[model samples]
Target chain A: MTYCVALKLDRGLVMMSDTRTNAGLDNISTFRKMHVWEKPGERVLTLMTAGNLATTQAVISILDERMKAPEEREPSIFAAPSMFQVARIVADTLREVIGRQADSGQKADAAFNATVLLGGQIAGGPVRLFLIYPEGNFIEASDDTPFFQIGETKYGRPILVRAFERTMSFEAAVKLLVVSFDSTIKANLSVGMPLDVALYEEGSLSLGTPWRMEANDAYYRTISEGWGDALKQAFDRLPDMELPTSG
Target chain B: MTYCVALKLDRGLVMMSDTRTNAGLDNISTFRKMHVWEKPGERVLTLMTAGNLATTQAVISILDERMKAPEEREPSIFAAPSMFQVARIVADTLREVIGRQADSGQKADAAFNATVLLGGQIAGGPVRLFLIYPEGNFIEASDDTPFFQIGETKYGRPILVRAFERTMSFEAAVKLLVVSFDSTIKANLSVGMPLDVALYEEGSLSLGTPWRMEANDAYYRTISEGWGDALKQAFDRLPDMELPTSG
Candidate 1:
């Protein structure tokens, strides 16, 4: 199981993903789920994946390999003219990989499915977020639905629905995502720490290094413990439930 | 679809459920999911249902009919000697109901399946809570677990996990459950308002009048809006996520 979330805000984009990957309770490993592509000052694209490790890694490897040798049949994400084109490249690559897996007598739609979250700025294009489905179709987030979460999403969703704001600062957005992730990590063991986070300021063409938070990172700890204490306090403040006079 | 939750606390039990039932998005209706049986100073038992409306309603109608005339093969739940026996009767009746549906060429395990949360106290037994499964098996809530949620549970679970206290006041428990249910209602259309809630005080031997919160109930509104605002305030107070000078 996995959890990856990305927000498209007025200021920019805030995206993060948990690092835990597991086939079962007995088998678990840490693997980075966020990928970055930067042509420094020219274009930057971030990709986050959740689903079968093999298929996602295969798609990433194929895209990365394409970048290494650009004179290929499929245009690399690096060469896409717009954010929409970049989404198309990623979706097509994901579909192609799943196709090969299906060709070998595998049920790629269910067992080997992988969904990707692509968000970034491409030169003149606006900062955008797209959720690419396992079927290769994709949907872009709009103001009404400014965020997208994949994998193990239900437990962490109510908080986001209650607190999200379009005009929140990049810093505030990151803080919100941290709280969301913390809630998910506590409710679900399949999503663990050592999170991969990337922030893309609107119009920043180049992707910079992202900060990774381990299990005990101070800021993450503050969000985790502080949010719990705050919730208790807030709970204490709610209007008391009155006993009914009769049924 | 449905959402029902039961908490076994030191003081007593607090249980609530949404009334929404649907075969699909287009086919939705309101149906009560909480049932209470109180024998004055003798005993009080509350049962909450979730899953197939047909199966759950059938189970309830059967139990009600049995109580109307206790000269039957299966003992009436009202005549059960202990909370454990109450659970057994409910589980067995539930299993039988599903079996009957299956015999009529229905898919009893999935489409017609139902889960029940039974909580109450009898003359000599301790206050107890049991989660009855579709197959007639049941599990009791312990000091550690102390709660059970059936149907559309994940969206409302994190708050329960974060704020639940075994020794809290009955009022506090109700407040917590209202918060949990409000969150579920906001995130899921299948779970809606006009919630039915039952609170049982230990040794009361009878349930007092339960409370039902409509969509615009004042206290429910306060908790719903207050919690959302309080969470936003808490999010604002959390330590800021510092952006690295380079990222």
Candidate 2:
């Protein structure tokens, strides 16, 4: 299982993904789930995927191959005119890879099962965030639901539901997201450390210096400790029940 | 869907369950998930069920019938020698009812799925909690894992993971459980308001007045508001990321 989350705020976009993938309990390994496509001041597109690793890798590999081809007629993430077209290219590539894998009998039940969080800004348009589904379709985040999460979502849902607001400051949004991720990592063993975090400032068509956070990263450690201590203090402050005495 | 949690602490036990049952998104109804069997000083047992409503109700009816039949050989909740035995009885009854129903060919794919949380103290035993599986086998909570939750459990798991301690005060335990329930209800529509809360003090052999909490109840409203505000405040206090800019 994987956990990836993205928030699109007025300041910019914040994306985080865990680096744990497992075929089974004994076959656990680390795999970065975030992919970045950058062309300096032209476009910067970040993709975070959750689902079967093989299928996602295939889709990424196909996109990379297209980018490297000298013929250059095929539309690549680098050449997409708008963020919407970039999303369409990614979805279509995913669907094609899934169809090919399904045609071959090598993969039986593991047909393409991947959801992508696509967030970035083009040179001219606004910064946008989308949740692309497995069937090659997508939905943009609205004011009602300001963020999107994929995989192992429930454990971290309370924090998002309670703290996420459209008007929230970017600093508050990032802190809340880290706390949410901390809660998920504590409850589930399938999601581990060494997180991939990327931030894209609005109107800047280049990625923020991405942070590769390990288990001992100081900010994460502080968030974990502070959140735990705050919860305990809050628990202590709730009013105690007044039990009725037996006459 | 449902959310039921029971905790065994030094002071006593706390059990809470939401009352919403939904067949589908459009077909939702309210049915109490908690059932209590008490014989004053002899024994007091509280059972909370989650999963298929029909199967859970059938098992409960079977258990009730066993209590009415004085000639029955095996012990029922009222007559069990220990809380452990009571859990086994509940699990076995659930399994028997499910098996009988499935054999009748009324449903396919084992529609007989339900889990039960049984917690209470017998006259001579220590306060205990058990989580009974659909197969009629159960596991008792220990010092390591001193609580059991069934139904939509993930949404409320973070609070218990952070706040629960074996020596927690009864008042603290009840309030923590209520806050946890509020979190679950907020995140999942299938688990809703009007909760059933029961507290059993050590050596009391009978439950305290069970609180039927409605959406507008003063204490519950306080918890909902206080918890949300506390979380937001905590989120705002966490330090923000210090990004490294490319020179």
Candidate 3:
């Protein structure tokens, strides 16, 4: 299991994902789920994956392989002309990977399915966010839905829906996501740290280096503990339930 | 779909459920999910249902019917000598309902399954809480796991986990659940107002009249709005994410 989130803010893009993955309670390992591709002064792309690890890894590897052989007829994510095209490439790669798994005798839909969150900016295109599903279809975030969350999304979603603001400062966006991730990590054993977070300024055509937040990171600790305390305080301040005499 | 939560606190028990049920988005309807059977000063039991409406209503009808036939051979819920026995009766009723459906050519497990939250105090037993699955098995809440949430539970879970304290006042518990329910309602269309909440004080041998929280309820508004503001405030106060210079 994994938990990944990306926000398309007015000022830029903020993406975050946890590194922990597990096949079962007894088999746990750490693997980076967030990837970046940068072409300074031209474009920047970020990808966060969830669902089947094999499928996601295969998709990433194929995209990376295509990038190396520029003369290839196939499309690579880096070669996409627009963010939409980038999403299409990622979705196609995901489909191809799943298809291969099915050819190898695995259940294509259940065993090899993967979902990806793609966010980036092309040289001439505006910043965009898309959630690519297992079927090679995707949905772009809009003004009404300015963010995308995948993998164990429900535990962390209430806080995001309650707190997210498209116009908030990038720093606040990062803080909000950290808190949301923290909430998820605490509630479910499947999603853990160190968490990877990236901040990309719109139209800069450059990807910000990602930050890895370990379990003991200062900000992580503050958000985890502080959010708990703040919640209790908030609960205490709420007015009491006033059931009338008959009810 | 529905959202129901039951908390086993040191002071007593808090149970809540939303009434919305739907076959499809267009076929949504309101149906009470919380049922109360209180024999004043003798015992109090609240049954909250989730899953297929037909299965739950069938189970409830059977139980209610058995109660009327005092000379019946079957063990009725009201006749149960202990809370454990009560849980067994409820589970047995659920299994019976499903089994009957299967015998009538329905896909019992898929089409007729219903999960129930059975909680109450019997005359001789301590305040007890149990989550009865469709398979006629059940698990009671313990000190470690003092709560059970069924249906659309994930969205409201984080707040409960963060704020739930066994020693907290009953009013606080009620407030916490309202906020949790409010969060779930905002994020999910299938779970909505009016919400039902019931309180049981240990040893009271009686149940409080349940409160019905409607869409425009003042307290619900306060929580829906107040919680959002409080979360933003908390996020704002968190120390900024100290991403490395490159991030």
Chain B TM-score against the true chain B, each candidate = 0.96, 0.95, 0.97
Model 1 Cα lDDT, one tens digit per residue, B1-247: 7899999888889899999998889988999999998898888989999988889999999889988888777689988788888898899999998888888875535777899999999988899999999999999999889999999999999999999999988888888989999899888889998998888888888887887889989889889899999888877877777777444
For all the candidates, what are their Cα RMSDs to the real structure?
A: 1.6, 2.0, 1.6
Docking class of 3: medium
User: Model 1 residue B133 lDDT?
Assistant: 97
The lDDT ranking, best first, is 1, 3, 2
Per residue, candidate 3 scores C-alpha lDDT tens digits across A91-172 of 9889888877878865546867889999999998899999999989999999999999999999899888888889987778
Off by over 4 Å in 2: A70-73, A106-111, A167-170, A243-247
Best by DockQ: 1
Q: lDDT, candidate 1, residue A94?
A: 93
TM-score of 3: 0.97
lDDT of 2 by residue, B167-211 (tens): 887777778988899998888899998998888888888777787
Model 2 chain A is weakest, by summed lDDT over 10 consecutive residues, at: A238-247
Return the TM-scores of chain A for each candidate in numbered order: 0.96, 0.93, 0.97
Candidate numbers sorted by DockQ from highest down: 1, 3, 2
